[model samples]
Target: MSRPLKERKLLVVAVVSHAIVHICELSFPALQIMVAAEILHNPAAYQKLGFAYFVATLVFGAMALPAGFLVDRIGQRRVLILFLFGAAASMILVGTAQSYLMLVLSLGLMGGFIGLYHPAGASLLSLATRKQGAAMGIHGVGGNFGLAISPLLASGLAAWLGWRLAFAGLGLLPLFCGLWVLVDRSIKVELKAAPEDTDNLDRPDPKLFLLPLLVLFLMATLNGMCYRGFSAFLPAFFKLKIPAGTIPLVSGLVQAGSFTTLVLIAGMVSQFLGGKLADRFVKEKVFTAIFLLCAPFLFLLSRLEGIALLLSATAFAFLYFANQPVSNALLPNYVPRLMRGRLYGWFFFANFGAGSVMSWIAGTVAEKFSLAIIFEILAAIAALTGILGFLLVRVSRPDKKPEV
Candidate 1:
């Protein structure tokens, strides 16, 4: 097969895998209420279900590094195939779950399986494509689609079938993708040593790489805080600032749920553009500028009300998701080809693990102070991310790209 054909095939598999990762990630929340209502027979069981998902998410974040280790040993293709079959089985278990404990265990299994994607899939994208930023962006769009569709798809499936079938039905996508990959000989997943590793120019200096790697890790943690923290409370913040009766028909039409959907759709566009820009420009500078710009919109989001608040939020969401592709592309510059997967594991752990903490903090702050304060806090975090980005720009050599 031609190289370009192979790349395209690999991209398709990566994108589909990325989408299923998120579908599995978010589908539980969509179905949790139904699970509480139907199986537990208590609406108040929502909190318990939420806690179960929380533990499951911890499992998700915790598995990234080990998954990376597995990828480094065997190969991303094999690990991703495992993720597919494992996630499929877990989701099917969720469907068959007859008791509350059974449901929680199934969710944890689902988390563990889906958690394998980022390290494996992301490394595969970096290895397969020269346009790292564009590939990551396109891959991110798959995730955005998954996020956008999960609530509606899962809920609709439940409404039409039942919560059990909803989850089981969702599993069919990965199972199908897994089967396609298994039968298709064109998709390459084996790791080959890069020829460029023999060149000294391609290798980064260990001494100088440390500080920037640390900064990148810190910036990733903060970015995670901004992403998860903002998302966790955005609907509440919108409802609070722009109350149900605030904008007349607008209020009823674009309430919290619909507004979030709009933000996610906007994310799809911004992510693609962000990827293109990252490919065109100095990625670190582009990333830094995006994060810096986020602070102002976030600040505006905090202080404004009515339509102005909505516009600021839209701007913030645009800038927030735009950084994803740029940041994903940045790591290759600092890490050697062989270790990229492990670094990605650490990077996502910082992003998702540390990020999970911000939800609780934002909640407490909202209870003690106000929802608007959450934006202000996020604005500060964005500013810090920008500062780290600036430092990263100084350290990163943009003239060269990693070879795998």
Candidate 2:
């Protein structure tokens, strides 16, 4: 049976708040880089800041595969409650650090903590929602909220208390939420397990699993690259191009606005619409086609200036994030359930791992070139992902069960 309205609402609140913590954290990198440059008395000090994310993901990628398997085995609620604190702490440590080594170590530690969130969170959300796109939509929206708000909150707080405070503040959010989830464990959630075909459990089909994994990896790589460019460069871009404090506030607010709106629209609301359409329509092709089309809007938005740029950015983010719920919602249905967590973990790992590389490359580009070139290159990558996403249906197929 589906959860009661009140119960579902509570869960959404928790997940959404969980997402806000990430948003708060993600925004810290650029500001920290800037601050490190100013105080460390060296532009190169910022390299360690980005290195923190790279090193953390390297450690994290090693763990994520196992993490997913463990989620299914141990239960999502327990892991999230236990490990999210590490993530929260990484932020605090990063915030408090007085030296480059401290900053690097703290950031790496932070990535280690972040590594634990998705497997636990995504699996739990999938388990909670059954096969409902609406539920995932709401959950996706929560993540987007985190992504959106992080920049604004970090930049604003960084302006006052220093960027470290943003990290410290965000680091603590998960702890409180983890506590709440712990207290609420007495309540139970029931979901229909993905039906098993025992005969094929070990060796039913190799191709089915490989395809979705491959496609998702590719998509994530492109999107991750694009995301790094946008999130890392946009504020600085805005600051250089726009008026005083305009970049921080406007970039943050616009991002926040786009995130919340897309979640409500594409993530939550449009998700149900996509689901209904998928029931009768040619779902894969249609969805992929729609995704491919987002590039034009993004390209158009990338070229503008001032308020026009902000408005364009809002529209661009909306369209970009809009694809998330639809794409993620499609995965469970295609995969065999038992493999879902593994697949999701690998999916995120591939995305983030590749993305980390992209971010490093982007930073290199920024060092050598300019932020404008970086965004332009990312825009091109987005277009490439869109094209690849559409072709995915022809190249790959989902599994029969949706367990993991």
Return the TM-score for each candidate structure: 0.84, 0.82
RMSD of each: 4.0, 4.7
Best by TM-score: 1
lDDT of each: 0.76, 0.59
Q: Which sections of candidate 2 miss by over 4 Å?
A: 5-10, 42-49, 56-63, 187-209, 245-283, 396-404
Task: Write down the worst ten-residue block by lDDT for model 2.
Answer: 193-202
Model 2 gets an lDDT of: 0.59
Residues 268-300, candidate 1: write the lDDT tens digits.
778888888877777778889998888999988
Error of 2 at 2 (Å): 7.5
Off by over 4 Å in 1: 31-50, 95-103, 190-204, 233-258, 299-310, 360-376, 397-404
